[model samples]
Each structure stands twice: as C-alpha cells, then as structure tokens.
Target: MNASRLLLGSFLFALASAASAATACAPTIDKPWVRSAPPGAKSLAGYLVLRNGCDAPVTVVDVESLDFGMPMIHRTVEEGGVSRMRPAGKLEVPPGGELRFEPGGLHLMLMRPLRPLADGDVARVRLVLADGRRVFAEFPVRRAAP
Candidate 1:
C-alpha cells in the first residue's frame, strides 16, 4: 500500500509541473515605441518588438489606442518607384521567435488624432492577441528628426 501511495504522489507532482510549463508558454512584448508626430501632423506611427514564448504561433488581430480615432496595421510598399502605405490585415509571430515593427516596415498607423500629443508625453496602446490576451503598453512621444 505504501509503494502505491508513493507512486501516486510522484504522478501528481509531474502533472503539476507540466501544467506550469504550459502556462508559461505565452507571447510577451518588449520595448514598445512610438514616433512623435511632426508639428501640425494629424497622425503618427508606433513600433514594437514582440517575442513568442509559446510552442504555437500567435497572431495579433488588432490594436486599440485611446489617443487616435482608429488604429490600423500598415506597411510601406514601393511600387512603380513610388512608396505608399497599405493596410496589414494581421500581424503574426512565430513560436519561440520574435517580430519587430520599425520604420520603413510594418508599423501601427495611428489616424485621426483626438488631441495633439506633446513631446515627452506618453500614450497608452493595447495589443489584442489571437488567444484573447490583451497587452497594454505605454508609448512615449518624442520628436522625430526630419
């Protein structure tokens, strides 16, 4: 009877450890940033680095910003020697990997500013993950040199 009880305890411990490991497999965000709008400019852009710690891929479905009327994922493409902005449907990050949004690449297009953002101010942005997790980030406003 004692041997059977010991085996059962060991099995329970292993199950608990497995559960903890699975819970840790979620995506994380780091160093979220945003570019300050130029004087009198109505819109701005944001960038960030996302790390996927999960064993499965994660998709970013949408973004929400309190300071802008609408937030959309956008990318800059060059066609016919002209550069233009286009909408990105969704942002994806691979398992145990990272995705970076930087200048001249995939970025958040913050449109229709509700109010003027001053230098050194901070804005709150929320990123919605496909797994229904919401990540909140505080992006600083700084002057982007021309």
Candidate 2:
C-alpha cells in the first residue's frame, strides 16, 4: 500500500511540473532585470525582452508587482529638447516577434517598492495579458542593465 501511494505522489508531482513548463512555452520573457537605485529613490527601471511564439499577438495590458506599489509600462520620448516619458498603453508583440524594453526607450516604471530591494535581489512581476492570462517574470536587481 505504501509503495502504491508513493507512485501516485510521484505521478502527481510530474504532472504539475509539466503544466508549469507548458505555460512558459509561448510569449516568454528573457533577461528580465531591474536597475538598482539609490536608497530612498521613489522609482527604479526594469528592462526585458519579450518574445511571442503564439499564433496571435500577445498584448501586455498591465504590469503587477508585489515588490512595487505601482508598476507600469512606459515609453521614453524626446520632444524638441526635452525627454519625457509617457505610459505605453497595451504593448503588443506580433506573432513570432520580439519586443525589447531597454534604457532610453520602453521600460518598466517600478514605482515605490514595498520594501527596499538590494542588489542581487529578485523582483517578482506579472504581465497581465489582454486575453486574461498572466505571464510571470523575475527581474534581478542590478547596478547595471542585464
């Protein structure tokens, strides 16, 4: 009886692992990272590359983070002589296409961390998709862009 129970437990664990792997097969995030900021700073920058391998477009409508009070997607634009940032509403990645979030361009505005994040710490974030699915990514906090 004990042997049978052990076999059942192993099968369940394997099934759970396969489910997680399948969810990450499409619309994957690569090299997600957060830039380290000085202590007491209100905001920090996050960068990552997103690739969509699905048949249809993947639209990221919102960013959610337990580590940050407010997390948003933003684009940096230069108008005349001034550089400004505006909210990037619903960034879409075409099928088999890649979208980049880097410095001086599209980035994650990680505003007001719930707790102080140190270098080497990982910030957990979730990209809420338009189709009601969420993709998860872990951004490592670093002094330089990764």
Candidate 3:
C-alpha cells in the first residue's frame, strides 16, 4: 500500500511540473507607458510592447484602466488628407512574436479621463486575454514632446 501511495505521489508531481512548464511559455507584456495629457484634455493614449514567448498565438480581448472612464484598443488610419481613429477589435500576437503599441499606430485610447494625469504619474491598467486571463501593468505618464 505504501509503494502504491508513493507511485501516486510521483505521478501527481510529474503532472504538476508539466502543467507549470506549459503555462510558463505564455505571452506577456513588458514596460507599459502612457502619454500625459495636457491640462483640460479629456483623452490620452497609452502604449506598450507585448511579447509572445509561447508557441501558440494569443489575443488581447479587452483592456481596463483605473484612471479612465473607458479604455479601448484603437488604431490610427490615414486616408487621403484625412486621419481617423477606430476601434481595434482584437489584437493578435503571433507565436514567438511581438506587437508594439506606439504613436501614430496601434495604441490604447483612454477616453473620459477621471482625473488629469500629471507627468511621472503611474496608472494601473489591466489587459484581459481571450483565454480569460488578466494581466496587470502600471503605465507611467510621460509628457509628449512637441
């Protein structure tokens, strides 16, 4: 009976190790940054670099910001003598690849600012993955250079 119990314990340990190994290779984000809005500005933008270390693709479904009324993924498109902003449905990060949210490109649109964000202020944002996992990060507010 003791031998049988030992074998069961070993099997459970191996299973746990495998599960941990599989989860360790998931996509993650690093060094998120948000632009500081000017006084009386009602909206701002945020940027970040998402890294996919896994062998499978990951999709960013939604984003939540504690400092803004609404946070959504947005992309800037330039047409004939016109520039417009639109919602980005789902951001996909390819396997072993990366996605950059930068200025004049894909970025986070923070609307209806709850309070004016000053320089060097840190805003906490949460990104929800398609798999229902929530990744939290702190984005620092920086002045946009003219």
Candidate with maximal lDDT: 2
Candidate 2 on 92-121: residue-level lDDT in tens? 899899999999999999999999998999
* Clashes found in each candidate (C-alpha, N, C closer than 3 A): 0, 0, 0
Better model by TM-score: candidate 1 vs candidate 3: 3
Worst 10 contiguous positions by lDDT, candidate 2? 18-27
Candidate 1 lDDT over 1-146, as tens digits, reads 99999999999999999978766666766777678867678789988888887898888999898988998888889999998989877788888899887789888898888888888887788888877777788888766622
Cα deviation of 83, candidate 1, in Å = 0.9
TM-score for each of the candidates: 0.77, 0.82, 0.83
Against the true structure, candidate 2 has what lDDT?
0.91
After the best TM-score superposition of candidate 3, give how far the Cα of residue 66 lies from its true spot, in angstroms. Answer: 1.9
For residues 1-146, what per-residue lDDT tens digits would candidate 3 score against the true structure? 99999999999999999988766666677868888877888888998889998888889999998889988999999889798998989888899899888899989998888887899888888888898877788888887622
The model with the greatest TM-score is: 3
Worst 10 residues of 3 by lDDT: 22-31
Model 1 misplaced stretches (Cα beyond 4 Å)? 1-24, 144-146
Regions more than 4 Å wrong, model 2: 1-25
- CA RMSD for every model? 4.0, 6.5, 2.4
lDDT of each: 0.82, 0.91, 0.86
